[model samples]
Target: MTRWTQAAVLARMRQEIEASAPDPGDRLPTERALAAAIGCSRQTLRAALARLEAEGEIWRRHGQGTFRGRAPLGHPVRETVRLQAATPEQLMQARLLIEPAIAAEAARRASRSDAQYLLRLVEDGRVATSRGGAEEADARFHRGVAEVAANPILIGLLDHLADARRRAAWQREWDRTYRRIGVGEFVGLHSDQHQSVVTGIAEGNADVAEQAMRAHLLTIATAMRRGSDPADPGL
Candidate 1:
């Protein structure tokens, strides 16, 4: 039997995460199972896992076993194979259907700390220096709302939507839309909308939060549809 040191066990655990749960937020094998597979004592395996958790390479919940990924947004990724290939139009439709409800739930569920975190994300977008930075802040703000909702399933859904938003088809459409609207739209219009949602959430007003989220998404839809009229080419 091989005697695995703690460092060796840690390395093996990382290998297992990379090999088996390649996606961030995917769950890992149970501790007992991992110990057996790595040929290490449970003590050594436990030590290795603690190191990973401390480093934010993984996270654990009380009844939920260990999972791959960092401190925040540790919800497991859902199987979204078909959605990944969905058209940009369909993705926006799905977001319209679900995201408002998620925002309402965030308002209902958010603690003071959660609300503060969301404000930070909103501020990050407002102060962003570049288009790419603003887009990233926008993504984090949306995901941060789902995190405040305190539901793993909803967070996973948002994660998939976020992933779909990154597809090349979505990027092409978004870039065209953004070129028309420019960074000013991000700094002015979208940031104001995001601030409204955060305010509603902070005030614990579910209806306001829901309505604000829908309005924000609709504004994006309007932007996307702007140039579709070939005669106007609204750009």
Candidate 2:
């Protein structure tokens, strides 16, 4: 098999092992069995198994055979149940509290690649918004901010918040109502705020980045509370 094929086979094996967790120190299917199952040579299967063992997703015992290992633990939940089920207002409040600190950290710690990634996300958001694809752009923009923050703990917390935001049925209804009302100016304002935050980060101005992020989130909250269509200029 080609090197690429070997890599693909290895990934498949890892996926299978992950899917069937808690193997409880039992020996995995024999190398010959895995080779037959995956249509690869025994040598290829062994290489893949070796990689998995090195990665600690699987382990081998002396003469016992390979077994699935434990997965890494994830961070503990940060927000309360009430916060997790936040309304638009509550989401905005949480955003205001969380994102400013995130921006400040980004200013302090962002590497060149991180800033470039964020810029790319902003550019993509601009394109998506122009094409009337606001949701995708909005998600990308928020995720980009989390990336720039460069803290796994913060990223996990933000991810949970984003997940909650996506699951809110009322948010969709509000977007529909605002769009029906013909509000387009808010998008421009939001885009500007995004640019401001980016500029602050690029300049290494922690205070400015923090304040800009806070203001941007607060503007969103105000717009949502007023039932303003983010896309409507007249609003």
On TM-score, the candidate that comes out on top is 1
Clashing pairs in 1: none
Cα error, candidate 1, residue 21 (Å)? 30
Q: How high a TM-score does candidate 2 get? A: 0.57
In candidate 1, which residue ranges exceed 4 Å CA deviation? Answer: 1-81, 233-235
Please estimate how well model 2 matches the true structure, expressed as its whole-model Cα lDDT: 0.67
Model 2 stretches with alpha carbons more than 4 Å out: 1-84, 129-132, 180-187, 228-234
Instruction: Report lDDT per candidate.
Output: 0.82, 0.67
Q: What is the lDDT of residue 103 in candidate 2?
A: 90
Tens digit of per-residue lDDT, candidate 2, span 1-235: 4444867998878766655433433336667677776777888888888888887777654444556653223323333233323466666677788889999888888777777777776666565534246556767777777778878988877877776565333456356545543324435666678888888888788999999999888766665655645455543
Q: Tell me how many residue pairs clash in candidate 2.
A: 8
Which whole-number lDDT from 0 to 100 does residue 64 have in model 1? 53
